[model samples]
Target: MEKIKTLNFAGYFRNFAPILLLFFITSTGFAFQDDRDFNEYSGEILNNKNGKAISSAYLSLNNSNISTVSNTDGEFSLKVPKDLMDATVTVSVLGFQSKTLPLDFFKVEGTEVRLIENVEELSEVTLYKATNARLLVQDMLAKKDENYLSDESIMTSFYRETIKKGWTNVSLSEAVVKIAKSPYNSSKKDLVSLYKARKSTDYDKLDTIALKLKGGPFNTLFLDMMKYTEYVLRDEMLDSYNFSFDQPTKINDRYMYVVDFKEIDESDPWYYGKLFIDAETSTLVKADYSLNVDDKKKAEMMFVKKKPSGSKVYPTELNYQVDYAQNGDKWHYAYGRAQMEYVVNWKKKIFNSKYKIDSEMVVTNWEKYAGDNWRSENTLIRPNIVMVDDVSGFNDADFWGSSNIIEPEKSIQNAIDKIKRKLD
Candidate 1:
């Protein structure tokens, strides 16, 4: 967790529209434009048995790096060059049967995709001999080099961050970025360059204060614990937590050893979470974790960077989820999401307000680094750059023209409509 910068919009009413520009030296959009350069496939992923939405499922192209994650409603829209229409697409999730079809199978009007629960895969799974979850986790960490990406590459990712007052959104920011990704075997950090960005914020509705997540997409990127071990778990940091076996499970078609972990060391901030490891390869497939908000002070330290002297903020929720997708024999970051909620207790206010902030990103495309070394210092985004401050309004047609992004959930869609109305 980098930092969650909290700023007070005390004078929001003083100006109808005030643009906030936040820059930290150390730190760090919707509507379909008809894109001629690429073809768009739209679909809703549903559970075959019950017809339920499956959120965060991975939808990707075959034999290519293009990919996108399903939204909260199990809806997705993926874009690829017109020439790739003959390529295949696969939709997969944690406990569902993966489905693959020709790219042309999806209608321009959108397609309905249903995945069966992987019950067959789990039918005789429990019959296997039990193994130690802790050891499985250790082994997953030990084999990271062989199981994950091995070459330096450049990745194109779609990133978004939003803040809501309970269910109503106060801000929405999105960007298409190019990341100079370091090899998983190396300790080097990834560098990001902004390609295109757009934002819409309803500051007037925020009442008196605004909560902003610092580092934007970097918050979720750091949750790639397999690559950046210090953020969560590492070989040497394993001793700080307690690990135990949960019920074994299956992801896609592969067997997985599920393990739950909890912080036991009082010397550090507490956390509890689960790790899904590939049974055969001992590779980590997914990680779901959160800060133990039992300690108010510790949770605050992890999120709150600054706030007004007159207000007290208490974090109610802080959690993260990161998933990996396979390319050949090695896996790389596919999708990541971070969510947080907190209550603001103003000194003189009679009622406290609770606000939730959510950020998610998925790597849509990537390839080995080549051609011009585009690492010019001025062309990159700082780790703590506040994206909402840097971009304004949903006025860019070019942004929607080429990016493959998660479909906005219904609530967020409605929020955007209302904000657009007000701005109009």
Candidate 2:
């Protein structure tokens, strides 16, 4: 029996050896450190024209040896080595003009850097003329191939994704997902699976898949909407709504021609928003939009009687604020924040749950292949899934029992695999 148990353990390890190797490699390479080799400095970066805080602006010192980006509030903390006191700090945003300052110029305890917007031909222009120009551009864009609007196939990268659930306003459970190329054959076989610590087991050897269908959520809701320019303006799902360009603005250093979309018909979905497209590449950069849902009406009509007693009825509002950044030549979604507001009415008891979801992806590496052996070579890279337990706002029983759980890595890998199979 002891020998049999040992054999079983060995077999398990063998099955997951590739995934284990990836976890070891990634953990060692991306470990976080608390101690810095240099002293840290704090400051705020703002736009000189409007004096507004510039978020996500890249700042580097001593020729990129030390670098950081400003936070959403335009605040930054960076470490500068004492030896490089004379080195200048450079600040740059996408579409915006870059600024540099000598380290010696800042003598106070903290520094405030102001960046001025580069005057482009569009900056001093009137809104009405810009709208006309943008309308013409949109008309041209809508006539292009709709397929181009939603091609995530452009993203060819290896990344590890993590997902977690929150309790008491903190993450309670977590999971890690890793996807990399196979060693023996890179094209033919791609492995995918999930790991759960609560189960003390790993789900391995699942095949990677992609979606080929044109109208799925991955294509329609995300990719196509993101790659807006790929579709001609006439192809937009505007119903009777009219879209016109407003003004050219800079976001994250990228110049975006802001397009206003409004409803001409009340029957059309509430599609009021602005699309930020890269001025040079014409790629979609960011979209800020909102949608309305009558949750109370839906709940009253759709709720099953068997659900939890004292269940609440609520009016739900879904808000999505999404941003995309250019990764290489393609535009990939970098970060997204979604908020669902539910106004609950439980037997006249009213409350609200502002559920928020934040997600981001960083592509560590990408490789493209156009050969016949792509499928065979794809098999070598195995997927690794790590299940993490959420300890926050949990009783010992809840923590041990498995009531609260999350499987982020599995979901992400599944998404990748689905896309792959569809494409294949």
Candidate 3:
């Protein structure tokens, strides 16, 4: 549970050496807002005790279905309908006391919310004689139908992927997607169709080589471990990794079982991470994992699609995180993030090129829909296609209409303003 928020995009450039600015740089899109009937409120959630950012805090309208999670930087944006202006909003994070206030609280006070840590009474734990983490995971999968989403549903998600060359934001691609999530019992994959997309890239910043993400949103969705149990928790695969239980914790007032895992078999490449399971139902609450790239050559083959033959490419880090939130009886996918860093070395170059790729998807809205409505045609994107190249330019302010989106940071907002002026 002590994972670091590594990829803070706003301050990414400041951490490294100065970037070589290109005169003809490409800009981004605006922080979309609807002026007619909705008021968009932006805010940051922080720990009241230390003032540190509380990443991934969930905020929801007290009586409405509208909600959004705070990003890695503890920032979140929500558009309140004119009628709901007087409604109360509740913010909750694990191990912290929930905070409730009127929507006007943010409107007047302007956006910094501090939540106090919850003081829990510790009780003595009685350990069972047979404590098998693998068996518990198997039980989790066995009860998936009861604890997880078993029926097909449509999820409105906001997806974004950004590429950074050294300290420069070389490319950024974003899309609002409609996901046809399949039932947990089926082997069918979730389908993603692009609803609206926008992108901007500076080829010169990336050293003339386009840094395209493979599978894009599809990759992020698979990070939902419960949906793709075969990727890690299969019966046969259980023997390949070592699992042990750690200290128990609380999430949303319920206890959780922390199971830490590591690869024991070195014959094949694998991932090592921890799984947070709901103690009451054995449901997968959250997963934070990273691939073990001990074998660089094999790992490179798995990640790279195409590059200059003379150049050497390898991945240094591949980290992933996924969170699921409860609605009523079943839990559904909430948020996912993947961050990877790679290095490229040319035959006789003075400096090796370093690039970081970050992709994240958040479920903004969801509802029950017919499974047969899944898009199966040409909606699927290929691995070779650069997502930015296929998307439309970020030239429209009303790009999303009334749909909700993860609020962009100040840096992104400034870039969008500059881009809109250039277009004008």
What would the TM-scores of all predictions be? 0.89, 0.48, 0.84
Off by over 4 Å in 2: 1-53, 56-70, 73-114, 117-224, 227-236, 252-255, 264-269, 279-281, 294-309, 313-316, 327-330, 348-424
| Candidates arranged by TM-score, highest first | 1, 3, 2
Clashing pairs in 1: 27-382, 27-383, 27-384, 28-382, 28-383, 28-384, 28-385
**lDDT of all predictions:** 0.76, 0.39, 0.71
lDDT of 3 by residue, 1-424 (tens): 2221121121111112222211221222222336577777887899999989888787877666567788767888887778888899888777788888888788522599999886754223442222788888888888988888788888878887877788767777788777788877778778766666787766666664666565657667878788878766766778888889877666666677778999897654577898888877888888888887668787666666466666778787888888887778888888888888888887878899999888888887777865453554325443223454533356766776756677665555655665566567
> TM-score of the candidate numbered 1?
0.89
User: 338-387, model 1: which lDDT tens digit per residue?
Assistant: 88778888888899888888889999988898856467542676666676
Report lDDT (Cα) of residue 88, candidate 3: 92
User: How many pairs of residues collide in model 2?
Assistant: 45
| TM-score, prediction 3 | 0.84
User: Total clashes, candidate 3?
Assistant: 0
